[model samples]
Target: MSGFVVMGITAFAASAYVTLDMSQARPEVHGPAHYGLLVAHIFTGTVAVVAGVSQFWPGLRSRHPRVHRVMGRVYFAAVLPSALLGIVCAQLSFYGLATSGPLTVLSVLWFASAAQGLRTARRRRFGAHRIWMIRGFALTSAAVTGRLWGLLLGGLLPDADGLLVFTTANWLSFVVNLLVAEWWIQSRGYTRALPSEALKPSISSRSAQSSASVA
Candidate 1:
């Protein structure tokens, strides 16, 4: 459900940026990083969307573990360069147009959580992996949300005042995005969730019988 919203938002964000930064005869901002950020965000977000949607398809996953794993690696690889580009681009954000410092912080945190989540998951800590990955993904959605809010508010404000409103509204996306994640984890009662090891099947002789039935 959340992934659907994320995919739509990210695709919109990418398209919006392409219009704003790339397609314009005269761009609003001509910074080199602006173009780079747009490219990174679009490519990586698209990859994430595809891979993420696959997670919901258990039949596909069951039949194609290799495909699933390959996409997982692609997501991880995409995050790294995208995250680095985000950090670089944050500094060039419009001042009074937005708060660069906080955006930079959010980008850094997003990168760390995502990179660490992938690494930990590879090491077999599935529960921790989900936690960190979810945290990272929540931040990923913020990019999309930020642009949406900025556009919405831009329409309400006068041309002269639109930039400020857009900037302020954009940063709120991160706050709102994280708040949604925290609320979801709490609402699902996963805050006190136990270790993955606790869910392992017991080693009784009857375990073979259970496994046979499942197979």
Candidate 2:
């Protein structure tokens, strides 16, 4: 479980590094508005990678639910803003996919999954909340896999065909990533650190208690 989490985060960090640096170096990669999207994407992506890495340090969060909550809040803060920017950039992407299409569709879906997961967990819907979080995490992994496909396609195809192939490959990567992660969850036994309902109170209580003791 921990390994998977690290792998997922590393992937995102690497992918974002690739995309962000490319966006900076080559004006051709993005349009005027794309520059703004790039900034948001890079900034939020860096936050997520740091937060995700912190999750693995057992003493950092495993022993301290308050710390976990703080980190989770940062993660959500990063994601929500980046997601909105992604919706705009998705419309401007090479595929001509509308903001209402799969590209933007994924952005909305990602936000919804995260929001619903948090909401249900608040309501003590443990299983459903877990499912939604896993789904959201899966969606996030697309950031990584999309870069992998682009790299792979770049090597295989000529420059003229490479960009087209990469775009198509990115679409396939997300579909495949979601399918594989879902399959693993259904067929293989994997569980997160805390149950969703238990997650909220545990963190909030810890935070309150810590603050009270300090006062």
Candidate 3:
């Protein structure tokens, strides 16, 4: 997990360098509006990636509750705006809807997962909250995984169509990530408490009932 976080940060750093430095001579964006949204997307996305990873560090939450809570807030705060801007920027993608469509779908899922995580946390459903947040982080990690996929595929099939590879990676990145998250949840035995179970009598209450029945 730590290795993954480090890889994510490294990828983000490389991308940020190319994005923010004018000397990099990056390809042109559509116009000022598109450029602005893209910039906002990058900034908020960076924040989300940085803060989101810390929330899952093995001992961070239990060892430092205050830091965990603060970073958790920062993660959700950044992710919402990042996802929103990502959708607009996706529509303006130079790669066309082929790439943009998948990206937009990713952003929508990212937003929903983060929102649900926040909602569950507020309702004091910590188990559900952790699961949803894991989903959210998986979606967010697509920024790294998508680039990794692109690089790996592009290298393996140098003659392949660029658009095809890009589109496939965009879809696979988040889809695979979410699938892995579900697997992890199940493997770890993370179960959501049912509404009925929440209302079930406590063990002590059951014991008391047993005594009274015996009497």
Q: Top TM-score: which candidate number?
A: 3
2 against 3, candidate with superior TM-score: 3
**Would you give me the overall lDDT of model 2?**
0.64
lDDT of 3 at 189: 76
Model 1 Cα shift for residue 112 (angstroms): 1.2
User: How many residue-pair clashes does candidate 1 contain?
Assistant: 0
Q: Write the per-residue lDDT of candidate 3 for residues 1-215, one digit (tens) a residue.
A: 66466456645554744555544423348766666677778778888888888888869988999999999999999999999998887888887889789999999999999999999988988888989988998998888888788899999999999889989988989999999999998888786442557688999999999999999
lDDT of 1 by residue, 163-195 (tens): 567557756877787888778877876656746
- What does candidate 1 score on TM? 0.72
Model 3 TM-score relative to the real fold:
0.83
Worst 10 residues of 3 by lDDT: 19-28
Off by over 4 Å in 2: 1-33, 52-61, 98-102, 158-160, 188-215
Backbone clash pairs for candidate 2 read none
- TM-score-based ranking, best first? 3, 1, 2
lDDT of each: 0.69, 0.64, 0.83
Best-to-worst ranking by lDDT: 3, 1, 2
Deviation from native of the Cα of residue 90 in model 1, angstroms? 1.3
- Indicate the worst ten consecutive residues by lDDT in candidate 1: 20-29
Residue ranges of candidate 3 with Cα displaced over 4 Å: 1-28, 192-215
- lDDT per residue, candidate 2, 1-215, as tens digits? 65465466555454544654555432244554576666666567556545644544668755897897687677677777777876776666654652226567767776776688668767876666656656766776666666677678777775647556655666765678678768866764445433565546787799999999999
